[model samples]
Each structure stands twice: as structure tokens, then as C-alpha cells.
Target: MTGKGGTGKTTVAAALALGLAAGGHRTLLVEVEGRQGIAELFGLGPLPYEERRVAGTADGGEVRALAVDPELALLEYLDMFYKLGAAGRALRKFGAIDFATTIAPGLRDVLLTGKVKEATTRTADRRRVYHAVVLDAPPTGRIGRFLNVTAETARLAKVGPIKTQSENVAALLRSPMTSVHVVTLLEEMPVQETVDAIGELNGLGIPIGKVVVNAGRPPLLTGTKVSQAELRRGLAAAGLPTDRATVSGLYAEAKAHLTRRELEESLRVELAELGQPMVELPLLPSGVDRAALDTLAAELLGTR
Candidate 1:
């Protein structure tokens, strides 16, 4: 899932993973950009490079989590292809890994994406290991270039394993098996970013998935034209001794809610015009915890 940062994209990604697992798909939830978001959302410690089964679903499928560190991924790549088993440490100690990850961000992104692609295609006993792979990818701001490994590698290497690996990664991203879901809030800036990201992803030939509106507030005051006087009267009829302060506060709060709800509806209409599937996650009263994540998972999968 890719979205503007702070749009709860990571949380939605975790919920989607759980939802897929619950639906009988052995899902792998991978976190890139060095954020332990999946672990934190699952109420577990940071995940290691190796995948670990973090949560089980209702259908007996499993959700395994991994945080792909570019440095570790680089070492794993070297060990796999070059048999640099011991020299990997030497390379890290010589600050080569740091230089590559920091000084060359495109290379870092390639390494990270390469690891995710590997997990997605990895199999055991001639069968697929993960039925689905969900990546809490980089924010929408960087996701375009991050997933465009072919273009990035073309600038770095004319020919080699790295270039070839990048081409493969790009192919996977553009393939039918991969879908990029863009998450956003029902606000101006986030919705704008989500729209722009969709366009960018389309231009790059990456398959687009759902545009999820996270933390969506329901339209509580629907199907009725409520006046301020009617709101005051309704509060009074509730048998509460209404002081001037309390009534004023109540009216203000209700008005604010109605305004926000209207704005959200407008944004929702805007998103609908894009002609992509849109998912709405209601705002959780108890905030995002394990139970809330499960609730959201149910909502995401349309089980609730």
C-alpha cells in the first residue's frame, strides 16, 4: 500500500494483510522504508530480516511479517549470488553498505523492492509460500521512483545482475499479480496526493488497486435537515439540564461534525470520479489497537 504519510496507510496495510489471511490466503506483510509499522500495529516487537509468523486468521491461514532493511537485503543478495558469506561483514565494516544505502538512495530502493519481489515469488516444495504479499511501501511521494527500478538501474548499470534484477522487479510491478493500493484521508491535501499518485502510477504502467479512505468519519446527521434550534430542542428533550455553556458547546460540536461530514462526502465523490475501487474505513472509537485492527480487517474484507 502506498499513500501520503500520516494517512494511516501502514495501519490499513496491516489490516488488509490480516483480512487476506483470514480469507485463507497465507499472506506475507512486508515493511519497507525501515519502519516497524507492521510490528507496532500487531503489538509485537520489531520484526527481523527473516520472516516470522505474527498472527493467525480465522480460516487457519497465517500472516508472516518482515521488515526489509536495505543493508541486510544487500548482504543477502551478495550471499545468494556471489557466495560472499564472510566478505559480507567485511563489506559492511568498510562502510560500503552505508554508502550504498545513504549516498545512493535509488540503489537502496532497488534492494528493498528486490527483497519484496523475492518474498512474493518465493516458493517451497514447488508450491507458493505466500498466497499474497502486502507491502507497506514508501509514501506516495517517493513510490513512483522507488518502484521504477528499471529506469533507475538503467542509469546505474548498462548490463549486469543488478540491472537484470531491476528489470525483473519492474516487470513484477507491472504484472497482473501486483496491485498498488493508494490510501488517503477525506481531506484536501491527502486526497490530492492520492489522486496525483494514481496518475503517476498509471503513467509508469503499474497496476492500481483500491483507493482506501482511512479513518473515515460517518455522516451522523444524514437524511435530515437539522436546524440549530432543533438541535437545541433535541438536546433539551434528552432530559439533561442544559446550561447556556453546555448547549452552546453541543451546537458547535454538532455543527463542526456536520461540516466535516459534508466535506468528506465531497471528497468521496471526487475519488469516485477516478473510476477505481474505493474502500472506506470508519474511524475507530477506541483508536487502533489489536482489536481495532481486527475490526478494521473485517471491515476491509467486507465481512463486517
Candidate 2:
């Protein structure tokens, strides 16, 4: 899942992992940003480089999370393909890994995404390890370049293991099984970015998945205008103050709510034009906690 920085893509990705893990399916949630956002969202301490089980479902399903560190991934890559082993650690001690990733940032992305690919395709006894894999990828602004691993690595290595690794990652990303879900809010800038990101993904032949509208609010007002007289009468009937100040305050609040509702509706219309399956997650007034995540997971699975 990917979106504008504050659109809660990580939260949505975590909820998705929980949703997919229902009914005895093991799902892997991967984050490459190195911010430990996943660990924070799950209310856990720092996650190690290795995959660790974070949550489990009542139906025997499980959710495992991995925060892919680029430097460690690079060392793993060295060990996997070149059998560098102790030599890789020695290079890290000399700061060579950091220098290499910094100099060739694209190589860093390769290492990060390569680890995701391994998790996606990894197997035990010829069976897939995870039933589903959800990557909390970079934001929409950098996502196009981030996921286009083939192009990024081509500039660094023309025909080597790096090139081959990037090609494989790119293939998995563009394949039918992979769908890039762009999350957005009911606002102008984020919606526009979502459109642009979807277009870029399309140009790159990456499958576009659902357009997630996060923190959506249901319209409260039944009409564009509320009747002040009716509101005053209702207030009086409810034994509340019916003074002008109270009535006018209520009216103004209703008007503001109507205006926001209209803006959200217009943005919804704009998003609908993209013709992708859209899912709107409700705004959690209490903020996101473990219980809120479970509610969101149920919403995603349409079980709530």
C-alpha cells in the first residue's frame, strides 16, 4: 500500500495484512522505509531484520512483519549470491555498505525490494510461505521510481546479479498477482497525486489495485440546508436551550458540515472516474489502536 505521507498507508497496509490473514492464511507485511512504522503501529518494540510474527487471527491465521533494512539486505544479497559471509560483515565495519548504498541509491532500493520479492516467492517444502504479502512501500511521490527496479538498476549494473535481481523484482511487481493500491483522502492534492501515481503505474505496466479512500466520514446532514426553526423546535422538545445563539451555532455547524460533505462528495466523484475498485475506511475518532485496527480489518474483509 502507498499514498501521500499522512494518508495512513502503513495503517492500511497493516489492516490489510490482518484482513488477509483471516481464515487460516498466513500473510507477510513488509516495510522498506526503515522508520519502524510497522512496529509502532502494532504497538511492539523495535523489529529485528528477520521476519517475526506480530499478530494472529482467531481462525488460525497469522500475520508476520518484516522491516527490511537496506544495509542488512545488501549484506544478505552479498551472502546469497557471492557467498561473502564474514567478508560482508567486514565491509560493514569499514562503512563500505553504507557508502555503496549512498553512492548508488538505486542499489539500495534493489536490496530493499529484492527482500520483498524473496518473501513473496519464498517456499517451504515446495509450498508458498505466505498466503499474501502486503508491502508498505514508499509514498506516491517516489513510488514510481521505487518500484521500477529494473530501470533503476540498469544504470548501475548492465548484466550482473544486481541486474538479474532487479529484473526479477520488476517482473513480480508488474505481474497479475501484484496490484499497487494507492490510498488517498477526500482532498484535492492527495486525490490529484493518486491520479498521477496511478497513471505512472499504468505507464510502467504495473497493475492498479483498489483506490483506498482513508479516513472517510459519512455525510451527516440529509440536505444541503438545515431549517433553523425545526432545529430550535427540536432543541426545545429535547429540553435544551432554544435561544438565538444556540440555534445559530447549530445552524453554522450544520452548514460547515454540509460544505465539507460536498467537497468530499466531489472528490469521491473525481476518484470514481478512475474506474478502480474503491474502498473507504472510516475515520477513527479514538485514533488507531489495536481494536481500531481490528475494526478496519473487518471492514476490509467486509465482515463488519
Top-TM-score candidate index: 2
Q: Could you give candidate 2's per-residue lDDT for residues 11-78 as a string of tens digits? A: 99999999999999999999998899999988899999989999999999999999998888988888
Q: What TM-score against the true fold does each predicted structure earn?
A: 0.94, 0.97
Clash tally for model 1: 0
The lDDT for every candidate, in the order shown, is 0.87, 0.91
TM-score of 2: 0.97
Question: After TM-score superposition, what is the CA distance of residue 163 in candidate 1 from its true location, in Å?
Answer: 0.6
Error of 2 at 142 (Å): 0.7
> In candidate 2, which residue pairs clash?
none
Question: In model 2, what is the error at residue 232, expressed in angstroms?
Answer: 2.3
Which pairs of residues collide in model 1? none
